[model samples]
Target: MAEIMLLLVFCLLIAAAVIFKEDRRVRDELRTQLTQRDAELADARDDARRQTAEAVRLKRLVVESGRSPAERRQLDEEWQRLVASDEVVSRMREAGLSPERLVTSAADVATVQPLLERGVTGEEIAQAVTASQALADAVSAQGSVSTLSPAELVRLAGLGQAAERSGKGEHDWPPIINLSEAAGYSFAVGSADLTPEFAERLRSKIAEEVVKIMGRYDAGVVEVIGHTDEQAMGKRESNLDRDLIPVLSGKTDIGTLSPADNAGLGMARAVSVARLFRTDPRFSNVTVIPLSGGQMVLPGDAVSDGSSARDARERRRIEIRVRRPEQPTQP
Candidate 1:
């Protein structure tokens, strides 16, 4: 009986040892799970912090963008004022006037108003009168009375005379003639080639007006300048260097061009317009120079101040200017 009791106690001892081993294994597993859970929580916290920071940064940007610079505000105001009424623009078009001419007239008014309010000196008035008389004499000689005021008449005459006197108008340049998109000189998006209607207008309306202006000035070079708005052009391979000559020679179409940037696009469009002038019989003796103004120049010959970012039709334009050809270098 005692032997039996001793064996039962040994068995209980064995059972206890097995139970302790299983308990230790379970505790280690729980500990491992807890540690993994803690690591996951830490990662989640870091992610939330990053997300919050990004949100704050984006909100700040939004607020800052809403507040435009003072110059930008001023530019916006000027643009609003200079923008012509659609009805008036239509009337001017019917009168065979360029829409940009309206802007010029408005700018002139804006400039003169401030000067008039400050009052003109007697000396200035006298000079203006003499200039006007001189202009009238010239008009009378041609059997035509100018519709311009005596002052305006003289200014025009002076511009012409100044050009004529400056080494046969080689030194002095004439006012730039802006052919804005507002004047129906529009292009397809991302295209440098002129549409059929665009080409027709250039040959018929624009060329005729330009010829008349050139007649007024002793010009030997016609600078065709292309201007673009401040829209960002995405990355693209440029074909200008490889294809410019071919495009000019009619070996390739201008429509196939892909400019990498605004500057190249401007140059390509300028070249396209210049090609037309180069081919025209009227401009055979004159050099047609193509130029790119890019997005750096604003209307009224001001440098862009980063005031505008929207798509402005008025900003995308072609400007024609007349100048005397450069004199050849003496041998």
Candidate 2:
């Protein structure tokens, strides 16, 4: 009887151990399955959030595309107003154009679009518009307005790049310095060296303009500015922000020296022109300041680089203007 009781107790102990081990295995598997399900739910939520954001962006684009024509026309006039605002006009005069009126015509937009296309705005555009305009205005103001013949206006407009094509036409960069107005001389593309022909033309053309401005205004200084396209004259991989003065000098061989970028090229050209100005006895009466705009202003006052637009000829030209140092106010 005692032996039977012991065997039964042993069998019961073994059976209990097997049941406990099986329970643990099932519990572990259940916990793993739950963790995997939780991760999948989290991934699904993330995908849904991304889809919602993408849908919203597409919806906004659709709304913008449905704008009515009348709304667009109103926006156009508002755009025009922004361009003609007082701040813009004041900035324009500061840039050198004294506009008789503030309204922008179709031609104005045509002239303005190039600058607009190049991410130029507000005062920069105003300055270009005015500079190009002032170039025309200076020529027009030199003689009586009424006396300006049709042929002369046409010619002046062409050379000054003051022509206002319809805004709808293919956008083209106007000339910076009208070669026709500048005695038929222009710089070679991608070059700052003064050609023999360019040298002869500069001597005569600048002499005439300098005489006119000096006689008509209180100006006593002739500023010969060098402008260039955005193309570099130095290493393509170099930084443009660095100063090129170290490479340029009164005695440096300009032909051999590589200007780092547009600024260097423009300055070198301005210096070249300035050296020529010093040689002439007529320019001795006024101080000559050789300055560089360095692709700042384009033909027709639009802003661009050689890479930005295809109007290389105009962007690559030089300009001559009169500068009047401010006089001291009375105490």
Which candidate achieves the best lDDT against the true structure? 1
Name the regions of candidate 1 deviating beyond 4 angstroms. Answer: 1-172
User: Per-residue alpha-carbon lDDT of model 2 for 1-331, expressed as tens digits?
Assistant: 9999999999999999999999999999999999999999999999999999999878866865788978767767986898779787789899887666434465876777897889998798678878878767776767665477768777856744532443211233222234421444565544556788888877897577666656544467767677766654545533213423432334444454355677766776777777777768887777877677887777666765445634465566667776566588999
lDDT against true structure, model 2 = 0.66
- 176 in model 2: Cα distance from truth in Å? 9.7
Model 2 is weakest, by summed lDDT over 10 consecutive residues, at: 167-176
Q: Which stretches of candidate 2 lie over 4 Å from their true place?
A: 1-184, 188-190, 232-253, 305-311, 328-331
Best by TM-score: 1
Evaluate residue 116 in candidate 2 and report its C-alpha lDDT on the 0 to 100 scale: 80
Worst 10 residues of 1 by lDDT: 166-175
